[model samples]
Target chain A: MKLKRTIRQVFAIAKTDFLGIVRNKTAIFFTLLFPLFFLIIIGFTFGTQGTGETSRIQVGTVNLDGNMIDVNGTVSQNSTIGDVFVQVLKDANFTVYEYDVYGDKDTNGTAAYDISRGEIKIAVVLPANFTETLSYQYTDSLGIPIPTRAHLDLYTDPSDPTGSIIGQQSLLGFISGFIKYYQEIAINQLPENLQDYAEVLADPITVSTSEADVSGRQLRWIDYMVPGTLGLVLLWSGLNHASVAIATERTKGTFQRMVIAPVSSITVLAGKFISSLAIVYISAVIMLASGLLLFQVNLYWNVPAIILAIFLGALSAIGIGLIISSIAKNEEAANSIAVLISVPLQFFIGAFFPLDIMPEPAQIFGEALPFTKLVYAMQDIMTKNLPFEAVMPEIIYLTISGLILFVVGIIAYRLSLKRL
Target chain B: MNLNDIEIDAVTKRFEDTVAVDNVSMKVAKGELFGLLGPNGAGKSTLTKMLCGMVNPTSGTIKVGGYNIRDNAMKVKELLGVVPQDIVLYDYMNARENLAFFGKLYGLSGGKLRDRIEELLKFTQLDEKAVKRHISTYSGGMKRRVNIAAALLHEPQVMLLDEPNAGLDPGNRLALWEIIQTLHKEGKTIVLTTHMMDEAEELSDQVAIMDKGKIIALGSPRQLIKKVKMENTITVVPNKITPKLMEAVKKISGVKRSYRAYDEEEKIETIKIITERAEDILPEVVSGISSVGSKILSVQLSRGTLEDVFILLTGRSLREEEQL
Candidate 1:
């Protein structure tokens, strides 16, 4: 009978609190719409395509090649190799811009300026002697012919890290293709006996590449970010909301009423926890649904693991929130403090970025956060499609840390009750 | 000889260097309507909180419903209903919803909870439309009514109402008094704390006047007034009250006690002279003020009451202390 009463009391409080949130417009905005707003903004910005057709990468070209050719021993304009190279780049799905079209005289300076202004991802400068070098042929003392090599200068924007890598790789692939075409022509011009030696000399070594099988599905940036976004949603709904629950009640004079009731303080805290957990789950679900529908983020749906990770993550966040609530003097103060802590914590926990790219100290700190553990576990289950046992370490860490912090939160709540 | 419903012995509560309830001892018998009257910050609410287990006494014991609060807090809590000074109901919920929520916390459920909610809403005299509207939209009096209704959900034996009529208008205050009297008639022991002396005198079976965390006087209203041997009080409003005029008023032969107070609303100073007979002192008191060159605006005589009792014990008017 006693346990039954306690359960009833917890549910009663939870029901009332949940109803209070639903009725309050400000609460509804923060609890449901705010996180979805964030997901929409981020999803559209990064998750535009996944293994499908993509927009062309913008490239700026400063073609200074004179187009000089050794035709019958007279150097005149015959074949324009620079124009051919530019056409090659455009054929490879690059939106190429020539320096002369922009009326720029200095080649290197024009390329650097365009890259800085974000007008182009990368710049290619074909040197003035490019064709001349390719046309030059020499004979050693043994009377053997050799072709001169030409160098193409490629400049990538460092600020745009991902775009720079893709731009450089694409440019290099096209350049290799251009060289092979010229190599075949040169070799065909030689005698049949020298053709075999020239073909071997042209390409002595090669590299073969294949992608490692991770999930057997092509993943996009949005796929990697979906779990992190869910963690972020949980942080706001769980920690930010819970931090103000007790303080708001105290300000409204309801905390004293609850304290004077037959219910224990722990029971009241448990009720608040249940309410916060429900909100966290609701926000997480809405965020995931939005991601799936809007961005078409392809992720493994491990329902049980996802549920467990969210529960543990929300538990830890609410534990921290309770501690803040106990220390805050009023609802406004609690809200300010929660935001001050949560804003920086999102970055530190790798919710917006990856920990591996962060500094070592930051990586260490991020790896220790409970939300980071949740993100990691989610990534493994969703992005990598790992089995349940693969995320056990993260699950264990969250369980232990969540339980410890929650116990401390209860102690703080009890102390606050005494102060009241 | 009724059994005591509440017993507080040597209870003291301190915050830092200030003592809120200092060595206070009192007993409230079952079915008794007890009033704790004092100025603001006079420790009445602190003592009431101690009785309901919302606050712990620093150095003593409190027992409610025959259970020691320190040892069996939950048991004591189960037997008492607390109506805090502030309106504590959720603003977004209507009367029925708020009552149902609190009812469940006290272990009521199903048909019982529903029936009690309906009964309380009607008993509080709320109209059907008012009952259905959200508490945020209700008038102050309606909100106070619901605040009291929430406390009575479990029908506990003891109810603690701390300044329930603090901000109510006179009409609403009278309505609240009627509700409280009805509750008392049903044999529920109640402890009401207020700084309004008339409110204490009009409603209490017994009144305890507190000051500086101590109960200076305790008795029924008539008994306390008679115990102090107070007689009629003559109040004289003067155009200007100077120190010399106050001294002359006090020197009158029939004057037992004299104090000057400012009427905030009237924007005038008044001298109150407590005496065995107001008629005997009225002529001399007016002449005394006139001799000091202070013009007398008006004069009135009234019988002694609880405010007189508080003035006799503390030499300060309850209303004056509250203003200060």
Candidate 2:
């Protein structure tokens, strides 16, 4: 009978409390709306990567068999007789595009290569007399160096500002690189092959990546925002609710009436703590429901473990709020103290930035704050598909922190009431 | 001391270095409407709090219905219904819910809690507005009523009030007095502290006049008046009596306690005389005064009031004690 009555009274208080908060439209908006505003702000600030226009280039080339120069050093794949000299564009990745050379009659009438936008920015034009040019490789022609050659022309955009800068800088890189191998023929640093290669290599470089943790598909903006938004509920719940409940009661003379009752200080505190827990959990469920309905974030109804973690996280938050409320004598002081402490803690915990981007010391500090661990635990459940045991480290520590704080708050409340 | 009565014994409360209540002792019978009359800092509220076991006495004991407050604080709270002066109540809750919550705190639950709340609402005359609005929307008088209702939820035997009528309008004050009278007749001991002397005069069966952390006088209003010489008498006020005439008036034997009633507005002084044998002393006082300004302004005094009794004992009016 006593248990039944206690439950009934608890819910009775809970219902009135819930109604009070819901009826306060300003309170509702500050808790729910301000978090959404932060979610959007922080989400967009860090979410943009490889989203804007591509500036530099990624260029590759392959060299096929080379032919030696004939005895007069003028032997090569010389221009063929009476053949068309048509130029065409082709994909460049390690194999250069070839433009077969007919006898060079006014070949300069065609365009000079553009070295800004295309994959290779240039192509090689093959001489048709190349059948006889290979016969010179059998002999080393005196002291006059034997030449192996492929004449290439670079085509580029010339308009993109970023492309223009790299289009010029690569000339220096190619000269340094080519000097290691092509120096047998040309002793000077500015080799013709290096200059031509620089003009064609417009796309600079790239090394793309994929996360080993997130599988199947990349998370959308809303997916990332969901975890952060949920964390914010805990954060705000911890920072605001208890102070409002207790302080308003004090102002209305309700606390004095309550203190005069047959109820112990512990019972009053438990009532408030449980009420806060219920409210924060309801808010979490609402946010999750909205996520599944409006944002289509991942939801696994069978995952009791995830639900349990969420409940614990919210309870820890409420415990923190109760500690704050216990110290605050009035609504204004409670609000001032809560805001003063929570904002900086949230930032230090990396609710605004990923831990990967922080330095090692900062990462260590972030791990110490409860929200960072909570956020990690949530990310694991939602994104990593990890089980509850995977987040036990965080769960155990946060629960301990919450317990210590709760006990301390109760003791402090008793002391404060004693002084009163 | 009556074990059946409420008693606060040797109760001294020290706040840091300042002693607010010092070795105060009081006792009243069951069903008594007792007035704890004091100035603002006479420690009356603290004494009441001790009776309800809200605060622990530094070096004393309090007993409610024979239960010591130290050993049985909860039992004391269970028996005492405190209507605090500040009108403390859950404003977020409606009148009915506030009553229900307080009722449940003492183990009244389920249908009983609801029924008690309903009955209290009717008793406090708040039933009509019970469901219509929250307590915050109520007027000051209505809030005070709800506060009283919350206190009466558990049906305590003693109703302790700390100036329940301090800030009410005359109509509300009258209505509140009627409620206190009804409670007292129902065999509940009602102890209230107030600075309003006339309230103590009208409603109190016994008045405890406290000043400077002690009760200077305690008795029924009539008994206290009879303690002075004006049990069935009148006072004489004659303007402009000479020194020799004042000596002659004091020597009339039946006349008691001659003093000047200085009128600041008229800038004139009057000699007042209180006597049970005012008719016998009137002719003697009349023949002794011979100046034009010494004419008797009013000579017919019938009954003595609490104010006259307080003046006779404390050498000042009740209003004068208030300035302390």
Candidate 3:
């Protein structure tokens, strides 16, 4: 009979409490929507960076192509095809800027010629000796020239010149490649009777590779965030439900009524604790399944074990919630305290960033928190391909934290009962 | 005192710096509907809370059905059903649901829980609306009834009710009387405290009128009423032969206390006398009226009542205390 009464009381309290939770839309939002919001923010922004894939960098490219000029009725036999330069500038992270260069036309209706101004570096100039220099096999600035050579003038700019080093290096590299290839074409074209001062050796073995270009399949940001997002959902639901149980019921006087009932103080606290756990896990699972379906979160290597970790993580989360509920006198205080606890912990625990890049102390501080261990366990399970044995410490910590919180919550609730 | 009776032995409750229930004691019989009547701040709730084991008495022993409270806390809780003075209940659940929930808490289940809920609902007249409606929709009186129904779920051997009639209408108050009477008939020990004199007079087989945390008068309703000196009451009409007439009425024997009319009418007055009988008192009063050359306006003898008894004991009516 006593057991029957207890069961009936539990059900009675559970039903009313469940209905109360459903009626409160704000709780549902905190439990369900808030984590998704954070996930969207974290996955696209920090998640990509934390998991070793850098976000795309925007590089501005300025490709200057030169045109030929006629000087004193003699026209230069060099002109640059601008379309080819544009094509070269349009590679990854490249925003192309095309400009006209005028340097070797100082005598052709040009008042002044100054390539010293840093408007464009590494400009292509079609010099009057361009074709002649290429045919005679002369090298300019450590290069062998071919016929109809594209005269590339390399300039190093000082002001507004952050990328000057890379710009000059790439420009010189391209010139070297062009010059080397032109030597192959120009030198062979030269008569065999005429011997060149520079002897060309073409027996260099070309080592080719198509083996490890694994760059095309970039890392998806969703992998790291999916676990953190799930942890957040559990955190919010657990904390909100635990804190709201007392305040909302007290506001309605239902708590007062229950206290007057035959139910013990511990029973009331346990009932609330159980309800908080239920909300946390349910919110977690829903968020998990939806996170997987919506964001395609990685679930590899004993998915059941990952699920168990999340459940246990949720237990600790609810324990934290109990601690919050025990300390806070009302809903507003509880909410503020929960946010203060949960938000900063997310940063420390690798929810917003990975623990590795941070200093060793920060990582230690993070790993000490249950969430750090949980995220590590979750990420390792989902992304790192770690087996369950590696994650036992996290499981143990979460279990210990949960038990401590349960005991503390009971003690605090009983103390409050005494005061009442 | 019967060992099986509920005995409150010199209980005093101290809260922080204040003493709430100061050295108070009373004994209730096995089947008596005992009432503790006092104004607000009279430590009625404190006493009852101590009895129900919600709050511990600072210095006292409470024994119910031969079970000492300090030694047998759980046993006392199991045997006692308390209807708190405040309306305490889960507002989301319906009447029947609330009753069944509390009934189950007391160890009733299966058909027994359902039966008790149904019985309480029908008796409380909440059966007609038991289906699917939430308790928050109920009126104050209905909610009070549900609060009561929750208490009776365990069918306690001893029942304690505090201010159970506060929100009920007169009709419902009378109905509450019937319920208490029936409970008394079943010989369930009851300790109820209220400021409602009429309720105290109507239902209780014995009454304890408390003041400042102490019981000043304790007796049956008739016995308390009989303690007053007057049997026949006299009323003097307020008239213009006034000062002389007031003096003349004072000169007349048997007149004890005089006052303006109970209702503040200009021409009517009231006086009470402690006469051995109205038969002998009426003749002298009628003759005094004729002899004084002022015509006998009105003279009648009225019976003493518990309200007067309260007045005799406390020098104020129950409602007067409420007004204060």
Candidate 4:
């Protein structure tokens, strides 16, 4: 009979809170509209970038070298050493920009300005004597041939250190490829017996690549982002809405009325918990629907796992929201605090960007937050179609954290009631 | 005390260094309409909160319906209904929905809960046209009526009303008083707190007058009035102020004390004559003052009221304390 009464009380509070939310036009509008908004905005803005599959870095090139060289008695017009580098950039999935030739001026400054304005990421400038200097050969006094080198001036925007590093590496790879091709061409012009011997001297060693992935299918940014977006929706519905709901009850004195009733504090907490979970569950469905319709994301046979992930994510977020509501004096304060906590968690948990691309400390911090675990668990189940064993760690971590926060929320709420 | 419906034994609640309810004790018999009369900050609301199980006293015990508040709090709460000073109903929900929700919290459900809600709506007279409208759309009095109906849904034996008619106009107050009296006629033990002396006198079977966290007087309204030694006064606002008129009023039979003061705000000189029987001597006093060539602007014959008892015990007027 006692347990039945508690359940009845919890249901009563939950029904009231849920009715309050669904009946408000503004709340209903946000619930139905926000997930679609997030999906379209984040999906289109960052999802379809390079070759319509992955996000692409941008690199720019400026050929100041009127340095045309003749190959096999044919004049190579408008094709300098810079043209080869641009081709190499395009091959490496970078959208390359070719700048027009100008007189002696600070071309590096132009490249930096464009990068600062977010136009191009990195730029390179070639000197006029680039090919001429490269064609000449020098030797030591011992008669061993010394290979001549030409300077390829590479410039990058200091503001985008990551983009700059990518551009610099691509330039180095292009230079290595050019040297290998030049050696093979030179060797082929020799006699058959000498060609074999010269070829061994020209290229001594080579490297091979072995590629691996979580699934056989190539992972797109949308696949990673869809899970993180689900996490964000969880935060929106559970943290933001739940905190405001509790604080509204507090301000209206309804919370005190409940506290003074026959119900226990645990029943009150359970009511808030169930209310937020129901809201976030609906929001999760909306997000998944948006993902399928807007981004054509494949859920496959992972609907159950996805639902579990969403439930765990909502649990943790709602627990944290209750903690905030207990501490805040009013609805406005609760809203401000919820935003302050959730927005920062989004950044730290790689909700908008990839965690691997960030600095090591940031990755460590992101790994510590529950959102990262939720996103990874979702990705493992939904995108990779992994078995239960593969995703159990993330599920366990989320459950434990959620439980701890729930206890803390109850304690805080009781303390606040006592103070009142 | 054990047989009483509500018993408060030396209950004191303190916040930090300040005592909100200081060693106060009282007993309310079953079916009694008990009134707690005091100015604001006299711990009347705090004492009500303790009875409702919302607040825990620093010391002493409170028993409601034979259940100790400290141990069997839920049992105590189950037997009591609290109508808070503030309108605690959800503004977004209609009257029926609010009543149903509160009723469910008290473990009422199914057709029983529905019937109870309907009964309460009819009882509060909100069944006419306001049952379907949200509380935010209702007038303050309507909201107060719904708030009361919500507390009555589970049919608790004890009711605690904290300043129930506080913010209502005179018309609404009368309407609310009627509802409260009807509830009293149903034999529910009601403990009410208010600063209004007339409300306490008309409604309460017993009154506890609190001041500075202590009960200064405890009795029925008539008994409390009889406790004061001072007699009733006859106040006269003369059109013209003069010492001759004041002397003439003071010379009347049975007039023990008389004083004249000029009120600067109203620009009127008032003469008050305290007599053993002010009502019987009214004609003689009025004729004497008029014969002295003073025109009477207003004449008020005052009797000993709860307000008088409060003043006699505390040496301060109730309205003066309310204004402060």
Of the candidates shown, which would achieve the greatest TM-score relative to the real structure? 1
What ordering of candidates by DockQ runs from best to worst?
1, 4, 2, 3
Question: What are the per-residue Cα lDDT tens digits for candidate 3 across B1-324?
Answer: 464568889999899888888888888888789988888877887788788777888998999778888888767778888887777776666777677767756667788788888788876776575545777787777777778778888888899988988877778777777777888899888888898777788888899887767777788877776766655555554333455655666566766543333423343545444454667656776666566677755566667655566666666655556667
True contacts kept of each: 0.92, 0.45, 0.33, 0.84
User: Which ranges in model 4 have alpha carbons more than 4 Å from their true place?
Assistant: A25-40, A49-59, A65-98, A101-116, A130-150, A162-204, A241-245, A299-301, A308-315, A354-364, B1-3, B124-130, B230-297
| lDDT (CA) per prediction | 0.85, 0.65, 0.66, 0.78
lDDT of 3 by residue, A234-297 (tens): 6677755776676666555557556655676666666676677677667767767766776666
Candidate 3 segments exceeding 4 Å error: A1-16, A31-219, A246-262, A301-304, A307-315, A323-349, A354-368, B1-5, B127-130, B168-178, B225-324
Q: What's the TM for model 3?
A: 0.68
lDDT of 4 by residue, B1-324 (tens): 455899999999998999989999899999999999999899898888888878899999999998899999999988999998899999999998888888878888889998888788877676556788888899998899989988898798999998999889989999999989999999999998999989999999999999988999998888887776445867789787677877787688887667664444577767766666887899998799889888788998776678767766776767668878
Q: Report residue B29 deviation for candidate 2 (angstroms).
A: 1.2
Clash counts for the predictions, in order: 0, 14, 2, 0
Give DockQ: model 4. Answer: 0.66
By DockQ, the better pick of 2 and 4 is 4
True-vs-predicted CA distance for residue B19, candidate 3, Å: 1.5
Lowest lDDT 10-mer window, candidate 1 chain B? B261-270
Interface RMSD of each: 0.9, 2.4, 2.6, 1.1
Which candidate would rank higher by DockQ, 2 or 3?
A: 2
DockQ of every predicted complex: 0.80, 0.29, 0.25, 0.66
Candidate 3 lDDT: 0.66
* Candidate 2 lDDT, A1-420, residue by residue in tens: 766656655665556666677777777776555565566565454333222212223332212223333435565533321111221111211233333221132443222322222444332333333323332332354643354443333334455544434443443344334433333333333466676555345324534565675534466545555665566767776446765666667655667677777766666776776777766666666666666666566533325765566566665666667667767777778777777766666766555567777789888887776667677777766766677787789789767766676677666667667644
